[model samples]
Target: MIAVPRAQLRRPLLSSVLHILSVLFVFDLVFAVTSRSLFSACASLALVGLVAAVSNAKYESLREPFVFTDLSLFSQLFSHPRLYLPFLSVGKVVAIGAGIVLVIAGFIVERPVLPGSRALVWLAAVLPFALAFPVAARLPLTLDPYVDQCRNGFFAVFVAYLLNGLRPATFRRFREVVAAGPFATGKPIRCPDVILIQSESFFDARRLGDEVAPELFRRFDDARREAVWHGEITVPAWGANTMRTEFAVLTGTESFSLGYARFYPYAFVRNKIASLASWFGRCGYDTVAIHPYYADFFGRDRVFPLLGFARFLDIRHFASASRAGPYVADASVAEAIVAELEAADDDRPRFVFAMTMENHGPLHLEQVLPGESSSRHTLGEHASWRDLTAYLRHIENADAMIGRLLDHLRTSDRETVVCFYGDHVPALPHVFEKLGVNPQHSDYFIWRNYGADAPERRNLAAEELGAALLRVVQDHGNRAEQPHASEKAT
Candidate 1:
């Protein structure tokens, strides 16, 4: 390792010191309010430790340091531990739990720091806030969370981003873009029902090794051959944070354009924006969103309406859906799509956007059950093979979901188009390391029924997906209105 100069380390060290002092001051405030030793000095340390533990785990999995926006997900830690907890080692979890217990026990036995007159106690409590204000105001920050996090520490960088996220200038560009309005897809003589599926943590796994089964993505390969457009797609997220990719594809907006709001775009959205749903709605199509998880997980329930979705189908709609491990199975989502189409009695075109939850990760939490095929013959008995095995099992269901939908669309008299893509690759860092592969992109395809197959491969950024689909739709419409030379002469 290269040695760093002492000068370079000074700022980071000072930042850590300030962060510790802030935590202590906050604990003192709590103790003053309670007028008991309920908030001990040890409790402050425990809180810092917990934040550090979570930050490290997230960094390892997602290649992103924890920021202020991540605080929005604290409730999810309790609501969905399986999704977030597995990233932390069991030892860290146990140690953090023990630390919290010890801190609480100290509250009962410890003595108060300011055991004096009520006026004096109140003065002691209020003094810290006054002192803290100067420190916070003087805190030098670059305001770039990823870089500032290293120089000014987690807490300071977190607060910096939080402050910046609230600034009006940060959203000025996005508001301007939204005001410009939706894409102008001219009036068409023919319109087909559109079904867009955002598959979770999906990538072509056969690229991992030659020992991998060729039949694994047979249905995916078949779809590619007949697709109007098919290829890899670069998304704005990794490991998790499905909404980043989701927002990009739906609105055709780059995440960076939102500034600090990019971390959780939905939370910042208060006005209607140009999006796939809004555009479709304007064209007289009934726009709907389907996801087998809580609609409010990422505030999608409130935000979907803003995006022009006429109906939002969430966990409530999938109460009886089949499960693959802990999530609603991909097959169940496919079934729901078909059910939605059949339920619509009117001849009005439909735009169904489904976000499938199967193949979501924390894959290491589950094991390969008995009789499951192993990739070890080629991968040679590594620890990560289990993750690969678990992934393959769930992916089989995803492939089956694709095949089933394609078959249904082919047989239906009503013309329909299916645009499918993965939000991001799975959180299988170890599996990727063992296989000597580091995938940076996920797969996508746009296929339509009632058309001759002329497959064209086109790779794109996540934001470009919506426009690309529209282009395909418009090309078909243009061709439909054209007359042959024989007809023109007549």
Candidate 2:
């Protein structure tokens, strides 16, 4: 048997422990700018690691406006890194690189944790401090919510991770909530066709309670006047996390009931539970979802099918579609909706969930004409920048798409109910900060091409929009034989 020096054994132990501390400090320093507190830093680092593990894309602090999101909501971030990596802050880039290096270094230098070792004893002793953190949270220096999390570095954040693991939401509870709510007792509509448009960043910027030129949202205002029932729906997200709003609209399930799963619904809600499409399917409708982007983006290719859509059409099928900026133009998406309707089997009603990507960001990438009329909607300072001008132009395109879709439906013989809404406000900090719109609110309107008096707009959450739509279509199904387009035009 070979004899090893005691000093050699102790040195390796020391190096391993020091290596762990050095790695954790990297995370602490990186998170200090955003978290500022021990618990938040621990949570943020853990989340970033999880995302890096699941998706190769780097987190963009400057472009993405979320820190507390779950893995499900981040699938879009996994898209070709070329689209997002350029906007990442330098500190975040270093931190992410360091985090990846540490992860690699961990495998190289790591030793198996022995149950009887001093490291285990130390871990056992310090873990009790998990309770002490909350108890000492009342004291200023010890908890240090006001100071940067780098103050405590490893111990406080480690303890925070331990404490957070104590409580987690279960799928069983999620099922109970879904079974009781969106799945409970709503009659399916008899309408021949129902089109729900989760238009990307399609809200009225003027609602920010800020000054804008009267004609800034000319096309949107025109649609509002023509709508039969329109309202202000409080969507699930703010600047980012399109999945949250989209999920809520399809399922009619609020994020509040989902706990941590709310941040990443796909991770938890995987089954074909009763959703808007499922409800319609039960009523003899062939459901189809159209999103003019990569199929796997935000896991929509998987989730939409599970949500009971019989068919899903993504970017691959739209090879001939025209582009406005980074994505297919919303006008082409509108034309696609008409094409889907025209191609649908005449035997059954159709439920079309059209999600447009024309107005999707980072708007900074777009090139816009200098001093265009849409320039008035920008923050006076950022008026010359690409982000503001690009968003204004993109949403203007989205407005035109809405008009095109309505025009086609208006002339068609079949009756259709169209529910249109913005997923969330664009993640434009300069514009939003100056304007002061409740970032959670987005505009929504329900329209039947046949025409009805536009109702007063009211506040709504995305989860409630589907039910509101159901009520609208179900309450007034089977209208009298309508006149031809030529007669109606007259």
Measured by TM-score, the strongest candidate is: 1
Residue pairs with colliding backbones in model 1 are none
- The local distance difference test score of model 1 is 0.77
Model 2 deviation from native, Cα RMSD in Å: 10.2
> Candidate 1: worst 10 consecutive residues by lDDT?
1-10
TM-score of each candidate structure, all chains considered together: 0.86, 0.74
Worst 10 residues of 2 by lDDT: 1-10
Q: Write the per-residue lDDT of candidate 2 for residues 262-288, one digit (tens) a residue.
A: 655765666767789888887778899
Query: Per-residue alpha-carbon lDDT of model 1 for 1-490, expressed as tens digits?
Result: 0111111245654455556556766677666666555555566667766777777778778867676678888888899778888888888789888987887777777665556777776676666545555455456765445566666666655545655566676678667755553353444446778899999988887777787887879899999998989999999888889998999898888877676777777777788777889888888999999999998788898899999899999999999989998899999999999988877656798999999998988887777764465532355445557777788888888999999998777767667779999999988887777667888899999987755547999999998998888877666644455443234334
Identify the leading candidate in terms of lDDT.
1
Candidate 2 ranges with C-alpha deviation above 4 Å:
1-78, 82-84, 95-169, 183-189, 208-216, 373-385, 435-438, 477-487
**Candidate 2 similarity to native, TM-score:** 0.74
